[model samples]
Each structure stands twice: as C-alpha cells, then as structure tokens.
Target: MLTRLDLMAGAFRAGAALALSEPEIRGLGRLVRQGDVCFDIGAAYGMYTYPLAALVGPGGQVHSFEPLPNPFRLLAAGRRASGAERIRVNNAALGPAPGRELMTLPYRFGLPIHGWAHLRTGQRRPGRPISFSSTRTLKVEVRGVDEYCEDHGIDRVAFMKVDVEGFEARVLEGAARTIDSHRPSLLLEIEDRHLDKYGMTSADLADPLRERGYLMYAWHRGRWARVNSVTTARRNYLFAAQGGL
Candidate 1:
C-alpha cells in the first residue's frame, strides 16, 4: 500500500505519462482485437494497460497486475485519469503458484525506480557502476492466471503480456490452463540475467511455449524475426500459437 506522502511525491515525480512506445503499441495492436480481454503483468504505471484498453475497446477488458505500492498507486491513478473503465488494475503479483512472496525494490541514491523491482531471493551480480541497495521489501500476494480467469469467468484472453523481471517462466506456468484453452498471444520479456538469479536460463523460459506450439519471434532492427533461441540481453518476444489466435 502507498502512503499519502508517497502518492503525492510519486504523482509529481512520475513526470511524463508512462505508455508503450510507438513501435510496441503498433506491435501489440497486431495481436489484440477490439473486444478481446488482455493481461498486463508487471504493469509498471500503465505502460501497456491504457493502450491495451484502447485496443480492446470498452467492450473488452484489460487486467493489469503491479505489486509494488509506488507504481501500483500510479497505475491506478493513470487508469482513472485516462478514463479507461475497462482497465482493472490489481495490486498483486502473479507466479506459478499462489502464495505470499517477498519482492525486492532496489533503490539508487535512496530513490526507487518502481519498474526495476523484482521477485528474487538471490542477490544481483557483484559490483556495478552504481551500487543499488534493496532497501525496501513487501510481502505480496501471488495468484495463478488460470485461477484468476476461472474465478472471473473470463473464457478467452486475446493477449497476455508478461514482464516480471526474471520470473517470466513462472508467469507462463501459472497460465498453463489459459494457454492450453484460450490460446492467447504472449508478449513477454526474456531477460537472462534475471532468470539467472532464479537458476533459470533463457531457453528454460521458452520451453512451455515451444511445447504449446508457439512460434517464437524477436523484434530485430524494428522488425520481427523467427527465433529458436534467445540471449541474455533484454528483449521482448512474441509467441504466436499454432493455428490459433
């Protein structure tokens, strides 16, 4: 939860509105439809939520998940300000399993970049140009996407965007049923460094998608190319289901 002081400071310090860049928005528009439901996992300040709501339209709904308080507050504020009623923001994390988990919010010079917060038990790589300290932590609720959909009576999801730092695999795991049944298009960030923190590699993150017959593509030089493997570098990959939406 965010305190009054944090909300005030964040609203002013947040500066420009957080939304997907032009290329990303265009890329997403290709996958989602006007009446489709979508999910924006690790949604830091509605970067994709507002845009998704617009893409999906009022008849559609965009469920955004953001665990950290600072960004969660901003996310909710942005949703309200945008008047995107179809966008529902959730202040919780999602993982393979539903339970309480510890999330780390790193601070540089005592300021937090809400987007950088991640869920990991292990420490980051040693010695960077600037030292980042995990000065704050919050125990957040984790839910499975399959369970969430079932409870909410959501039969289909046109697209699901996952960017949970390094736990992208876990998010996919929780959404197994949804993937198998609904065949939603997946746009998830593949960052090997974050996966390494949890003893996972980039390839491990793509296993389920591969098993589900998802054709993987990475954006290269402003265009997407089919990829059999992803590197440790930070990038988003689009997984299109075979013979499905």
Candidate 2:
C-alpha cells in the first residue's frame, strides 16, 4: 500500500517525465510551428499548454482543456497572465463521446490534488493504498476531439499534448477521424499502472496512432530516438505522422 506521500511523488515523477528538455523543445519545434493550431488535452495548470502556446505564437491558437474545477480555474486564470492571447481554455474532458463522467478526486491535506483527478472507472483496485475521498468528486463534461474540431471549424492541428492519466485510449479513440485527416503530431503519457484501472495497456494507447501511420519516439539525453516497440520504459512518447515529422 502506497502512502499519500508516495502518491504525491508519483504525481511529481509523472510531471517531470512529461516535461520537454532543451532538445525536445527543438525536436517539437519542427512539428509545432508558429501560427499553427495546437491542443493541450488534460492540461493541468497549463504546463504543456503554456509551452504549446509559446510555440504557436499570437497567430497560432492553443486550446487547453482540464476537467477538474480547481485546475480548470487556475488554467483559465493563467491565460491573462500568460498573455498568450491565442489560447482558449475549456472546462471539459475529451473522451470517446459527449456526456458527463464522475471523476474521483485524489486528496492531500483534504484538498483535491490538482492533476490526480481521474474519471471513475470503478476498476480501482480494492483496498488500494491511500483512500480517495468519495465526496471530493466532480462531474465533468466530456467531448470528443472529432466533434470539438468540427464544431470549432479547425482544419489542421499542428500538435497535441495528451496526458489524461489512464483515459488516453478513450480520448484518442474519439480522435480517430482527427488523427486520420489532420495528422497532427502527438505527445502522450502512457503508464500501465494508471491505464490498468481502465483495463488498458500502453500498446493499446499507442496502437491508435500507429494505425494512423504514426511513428513513436522517445526523448533521451537531448536526442529523439525512434522507438520500434511500445513499452512503458518511457512515460512520455512522441507520435508523429510522416507528413508532420
């Protein structure tokens, strides 16, 4: 059983793993260009969102989405300070369909952990380490990437950063059309420990992009190395279509 501190460390490691290094910034520069549209799905406090916003510039647009209310408020408020006027923050989660889903919020000192709130899959292992507060739940609105793009008249998305805990599969599942047609490069966080709650493997998350003619790569020591197989060795993966890469 993991303690609350252990869970916090896990969350910290997850963030550190997702952050782009100097070379990674350069590598992503090619895929994420100025004046191009981008998305930061599962954006918590705009970590990836602000970076995407910076790369896209004023001419480009970065759409950021966070389901939890606490993070959503922070994300929206940061827009003014970020002054990356092209960014639009939304308080909704992107899933396979449009509906409402209850998210079980993790807690530390009785406050909701910013990024630990995940969709209630009910598969949470019984007698799991730290107890999650049942009352600390929020029903978040869910939308599909395909529908959101269509509704917004967005034609081409330059890149997307998806780190929705274990729900990456469903998000991409809804994005099949978008990935097929627009061919945007993707940065994803895939961890089986989290995915297992939803009965998914890392391969299941990467397969969607693979089927769309995308290749996976891992950032190591300031260089991008092509990954031949899908594994959890690297928590963050860059999936790019040939056209974008």
Which candidate number has the best lDDT? 1
Question: What is the Å distance of residue 245 in model 2 from its true position?
Answer: 2.7
For model 2, how big is the CA root-mean-square deviation? Answer: 7.7
- lDDT value, residue 119 of candidate 1: 76
lDDT tens digits, residue span 1-245, model 2: 65332343244445555663323444555677889999889988766666666667668998999988878888888776555568899999998888898887777766766655678743554222555554376788998999999999999887888888788888888888888888888888878777877877787777767876888988777666789776756678899887555
Candidate 1 TM-score over all chains jointly: 0.84
Off by over 4 Å in 1: 1-22, 121-130, 221-223, 232-234
The window of 10 residues in a row where model 1 has the poorest summed lDDT is 13-22
By TM-score, the best candidate is: 1
For candidate 1, the C-alpha RMSD (Å) to the true structure equals 6.4
What are the candidates' C-alpha RMSDs?
A: 6.4, 7.7
